[model samples]
Target: MIVVLIGYMASGKSTIGIILAKKLGYNFIDLDEYIEEKEKLKVKDIFTLKGEIYFRKKEAQYLNEILNEENRIVLSLGGGTPCYGNNLDHILNQTGVISIYLKAQIHTLVNRLKNEKSKRPLLAELENGDAVTEYIGKHLFERSHFYNQANITISTDNKAQNEIVEELVLALF
Candidate 1:
């Protein structure tokens, strides 16, 4: 089974994905890192150098490749992966692939992302926590539709990593 963890920035997809993979005894892949490796450019660099349109096209291509080839894997996707093109449809239609959304509240996301904005291209421009909070609130509102399309949705608010993994494991089996 390929378990794809999807959620917005700072939603703990990568962190929880590692724990979930360990629990399930599956290999883990972070899709952003995968793209960075393949393109020899960081996601921010890709966006800055080639533009978002190019990045999205390549993102879709790589996502398709990974979904087609991998099995028994825990894949953590970038926040915007599902909202572009037919990527969500691909994940939903694929056999033996379970798409899980790591749902987090706006306040949760703001709190988490405020400190890590430097690492996230999308959030890097915000000047303060309040601004970050407002941005995330609006972003999450827009992205929820795509995220809610996941086969399974797990709330990560006020949840410990292991506890969330336990919940995900329960949901999967």
Candidate 2:
């Protein structure tokens, strides 16, 4: 089975995904990192250089490639993965794949993402913690419709990694 973890930035998809994969003895792949490796550029650099349109096309291509080719993978997706161009439908319709959304409150997301803005190209332009929080609130509101399509939704607010993974495991079974 392929377990696809999807959520907005700093929602712990990658963090908890690694743990879940380890415990399940599945291969772990962070889609952004996979793109960076394949494109030979950091995701930020890709956006700065080739632009988001190019990046999104490649992202969809790579996502399809991985889904068709891999098994027993815990795949951590970029925040916008599901919202783009039929991607969510692709994941949902694919055989042997289960999509999980890591749901976090706006405040929880703000706390986790505020300090990490520099790492996120989309959030890099925001000027303050308040800005980050605001952006996340609006963005999450827009994206929730896409995210809510997940087979399982797990809240990560105030939860440790192991706790989240435990919930995921139970949800899976």
Model 2, C-alpha of 69: deviation from truth (Å): 0.2
Residue 97, candidate 1: Cα error in Å is 0.7
Best by lDDT: 2
Steric overlap count per candidate: 0, 0
- What is residue 106's positional error in candidate 1, in angstroms? 0.8
**lDDT accuracy of residue 135 in candidate 2:** 92
lDDT of 1 by residue, 70-166 (tens): 8899999999999999999999999999999999998888888777888888988889888888888888899999999999999999999999999
Once superposed on the true structure, which residue ranges of model 1 sit more than 4 Å away at CA? Answer: none
Worst 10 residues of 2 by lDDT: 109-118
